[model samples]
Target: MSDSNTTHFTNPSTFILLGIPGLETAYAWISIPFCCTYTISVLGNFTILFIVKRETSLHKPMYYFLCMLAITDLVLSTSTLPKTLSIFWFNSREIDFSACLTQMFFIHCFLAIESGIFVAMALDRYVAICHPLRHSTILTNSVVAKIGLAVLLRSGMLTLPFIYIGSRWPYCTTNIIPHTHCEYIAVVRLACGDIRISSYYGLFAVFFVTGLDVFFISVSYTQILRAVFRLPTKDARLKTFGTCGSHLFAILAFYIPALFSFLTQRFGQNVSLHFRILIGNVYLLVPPMLNPIIYGVKTRQIRDRLLQLFSRKWA
Candidate 1:
């Protein structure tokens, strides 16, 4: 298996995904739970997006960004999971190179959008908290729309190179992928041709975007802390921080697993593939599951609204 990767082969055919090994015995039971969770994630995110669009009260910058994030979640979860579950249940794990690259394209695109929207949301909260009087003026609808466009343009452009790079690298005869979806790094690492450019470009892009976003988030929070301390009333400071707490939690939850996965990939080459797959799932799936829950907890108004909706439905 190790030597097979280096030998170039012309017939780059269909690949089999060796989904988390040894779980086949319980595949039936696993499918049921996985399908339920996946459906709920997609449905919940779609519902949030709808509610945000339908409710005029959520037209503010924060909720505008939340709606965008919901859209990202819906697309991201939908793009990767349903097919994966189908493969697990039906044993239809074969995928051609072109299809794999397409999957890789959306994965990175959605990831970039996720990070971009998160940074924008954090900035929105910072402005709202530190400059409450001018919040409406600063976060105008036009401004929010521009931010959304910029994120889409930037993420889409950044991922185009990846598509080009993928096209150039011919696959070897060995046709086994280790995980469910076409992870960018994992896919590129399998190429028989030179991947120095892809590796360099990818690492630099990840560090540049995710790193800069983290830095900006840190700076925003620092300013927020200073502003909070100067508040005359404790209640005022708490309220201000509370506004951003959800965004902060979501950022941490999403970024930490991602950073860890990439770092381990770079340095922990000797680690078992099973562990890597476990962390990969955590990186991909956990964030979407946590984002809405975190926001629901942090924002009392949103929380109350969701609870009221659920109660009315269940009653």
Candidate 2:
């Protein structure tokens, strides 16, 4: 029977993405919003990169981290959005096995790197607000570059194992993934082999990367808050808090939906498939869209630079 099973089942070379299960009829309608979201994300992040690069006044650790973040967001969204739109618009849902794994790697890798950038941004805030005198020395360009390199190396190393594990799995079962993008667990669950190890490693990676980032960000903000409160004047306190407000909003914009999607994917067994998939897509889409907007509105330097650029263009 085992020999017969082996003879009957072979690994699939490609997998079919179902886009959104149970919402097949609305795929076209859904594609409209997704298309708009991707457009906005691309334009906004590129604007950020452009503004930061052109303005020498914006050359600081904070903006350097912002540049890293902009690049990451671009790659992160690009890794999945085009294919997702293709599936929706052209009914092209088949993804080659190697391509699927590559998609999975970039998606997860940049997500982790984004989390790392948030931590670096939080540390920048903590230093700027709490140790204002030492901020420049502590987070110099050299230090920022080192931190960026470390983030890339860490995310790539941690996520590289997913490719190995994903490739090694024998997929004798159906090659239909229910989600639009090739999410790690969604792809792994299709394997006929036991997936406990993959599942456990995934959970560990999430906790290790996101968990530590969240912890450091929390500590940094706590210290920042303390330093802000200790300022003698209300104006001083407000000024310090203003510096961090954008970072706080960007962090919430990212982690909240991310946490919801993670929870629903893992424990919301009763949740509707379409709802979970939509939330997951939103988690990935909204942050890249919002980060630039939040920073543009809240950070005075960026806002001023944007105004100048627009005014010059109009002139």
lDDT winner: 2
Each candidate's root-mean-square deviation in Å? 2.8, 2.1
Candidate 2 lDDT over 15-62, as tens digits, reads 999999888889899999998888998998899899999999999998
lDDT of 2 at 157: 98
**CA lDDT of 65 in candidate 2?**
91
The lDDT of each candidate is 0.78, 0.88
Question: Over the full model, what C-alpha lDDT does candidate 1 score relative to the true structure?
Answer: 0.78
TM-score of each: 0.90, 0.94
lDDT tens per residue, model 1, 42-156: 7667667766666678778888887888788777777777767877788878888778878888878888899999888878877976898999998899999999999999899
State the local distance difference test value for candidate 2.
0.88
The C-alpha stretches of model 2 lying farther than 4 A from their native spots are: 1-11
